[model samples]
Target: MAIICRNTIEAINHLAFRLDLGPDDVVVTTVVEHHANLLPWRRYAKVRYVECNPEGTFEPDAVAGALRGNPHPKLFAVTGASNVSGWLPPVGGLIQLSHEAGVPVLVDAAHLAPHRPLLAAADYLAWSGHKMYAPFGAAPLVGPRRTFAMGDPFLAAAGRSTWCRSTRCSGTLPQSARRPDRPTSSERWPSAPLPVPSQPSGGRRSAHNEHLASRLRSGLGAIEGSRVLGPGPLVPTLPVASFVVEDVHHALVAARPAAEWGISVRHGRMLLRPPLPASLARD
Candidate 1:
């Protein structure tokens, strides 16, 4: 049941190899991570950034004002939504101000798992797989106790049987990732997809992706240079859009509806945001 194919980066390498993180551990990302939850936790922890205002959103007093002029944080990664302004990161007031500064909050909810649903109170919650509708497989991180640990035997003598650790928690996960309630990543991958019901079915949690994102926000609100960023409840959104058409070329209006009718959508410069200006990042 561990079918975690939702916006993939193997959920930040399953939370940095289940937080065996080092190099003076100090992770805290936000600028809108899609680089698979920010480059494998920035190639193994030691990063701190949380900025995205000027109305792009991810505010909690602008991430506690960038964790008060930053300088060595413990951990505070975020993104419960905002794959180019579907916008959502207030996540219970940024997990109560990064636990009142004891600092520990990870959530990359890759475009908020196709629409929305996060049980809140987080220590971790990574995401990805081309943003949740599946076509890329595996990516999820929901950490705490032991900060993240599933077990790795050089990913099992390199037979690569889905890199073991009981396939990262087995069938019907979340009883602390199951297996008599956690027996170590289920002997190397395969089992962990059945805990999506704290209130499943439109009452909450990806209820068929918020009913196909409210039919893509009523068809991108009848298009025309569009306008819909982080509407309602901050970011429990889908039908994701970030428009400004006019002279066109937002990749040719998203590639002329995917070359006339194929329709897939998604343009540039949202690689967590700041990485633009390399000549508008090779448009």
Candidate 2:
């Protein structure tokens, strides 16, 4: 079953709440997640973080260690892709590893879903609509019904009730709604078809983005004081690139171009902190 949330934050929060985590519970996660995936679990459970390499990538051994080493691990949370370095983790393999260790897996696919297929192997999955160019907030938390069968939703409201009779009510699982719930609208969001990389136009778009990223890397590297971070362009990644120019503040790197030449870029430490050096946190 799926619950439509206002965003990935709420979706993940709902999942974390329904899991009924306690202070003694441990959650195994990686350093590559956005705060949406990381913070929710922190609210209730002790977190065991799996560290990544300089390139924002981690091996299955790391996951294995966390799963086997941590006490009371109830879930394994991971990002399908990194928003900062555009690194794609081996999610399917990670999910299998988690299962073997008897921990369910939750894949935060907000960044990855826009570019590739969703990981079907994940026991629970969450992704946002804004990342997919959807018009408004709509994110889905998908998982087994039993997890949500008994809990009061993270948020309780009139909209969540399928029907109300006297003091008794039948409500949606883990209510992640804002206003009066319209099942049709929320249900349609996840079912909506997205462009697949295998399609002709999608192939072209992918090629174009890769070409752009390659050129971006080459261009930035050629600049006297600048260096591109993360894996080289040959690595399969989203079109995103992060870099730094020596002796320049990251804010200045992003602002100058946008103000002077209409070139918009983003900067600052992405929510995932460690992989990015304090100096090279521009995108």
Candidate 3:
């Protein structure tokens, strides 16, 4: 089943309610997750962060260790891709580990869906249409129907009802009449159709982006006093990269180029700070 919302944040908030998380329940998540993935769990449950390597990637052992330690984990939440470093973590491996421990996984695919296909093993997936070149204000949370039916409704809208009465109402509505009571998967999605382009076209775009990103990485590495964050060569990554210049604030680096050469780049903490060892930070 799918539940449509304004954005990924709203979808996560709704899922949090459905989970009925409390102080006793822990949610295992990675340190490299976006605020959209972390904040919701933090607000509703006891969050146990699985530390990622300096490159914003995690090994299967790390995830398994976290799951083993948390005896009462309600869910495992992770991002399909790092929004800042553009690193695509091993989501399939993580999901497998979580499932072995009897835990469900929620994937925040807002960044990954636009660039790569999602892993089918994920228990729940959330993405925004705007991230994939569609108009803003439409995001969907896809998961099992039983999951939604197991919890309280996220909202108290009139359309959620099967019948109404002025005084006391006595009987259940027929299944056909109660169609509006539970929204079908199709009705929960955007009204407009989303078509997938040919695989050849997508492959061409991916190849081109990879070429440009490789060049960008090489060029940035040659520059004096530059430090790039995330995994080394041959790792699948988005066309995006994040770096910091030695002895310079990120804000200044972003501002100077835009002001002088009309070049735009994102800076700051990127909403989530990955754990970096002292040795890596010193570099």
199 Cα displacement, candidate 1 (Å):
40
C-alpha root-mean-square deviation, each candidate: 17.9, 6.3, 6.5
Name the lDDT of candidate 1.
Answer: 0.58
Model 2, range 233-262, lDDT digits (tens) per residue?
678767777887878888999999999999
Instruction: Tell me the TM-score of model 3.
Output: 0.80
lDDT of 3 by residue, 168-241 (tens): 22136553454322553333455442435543446776687677767777777778999887877578678788
lDDT of 1 by residue, 151-236 (tens): 33213343322323644523233444322213233323323333444545544555565566666766675787675554543344
How many residue pairs in model 3 have overlapping backbones?
Answer: 0
lDDT of 1 at 31: 60
Model 2 residue 227 distance off true place after TM-score fit, in angstroms: 2.5
Measured by C-alpha RMSD in angstroms, how accurate is candidate 3? 6.5
Ranking according to lDDT, highest score first: 2, 3, 1
Q: Estimate each model's TM-score.
A: 0.30, 0.81, 0.80
TM-score of 2: 0.81
Task: Quote the lDDT for 157 in model 3.
Answer: 50
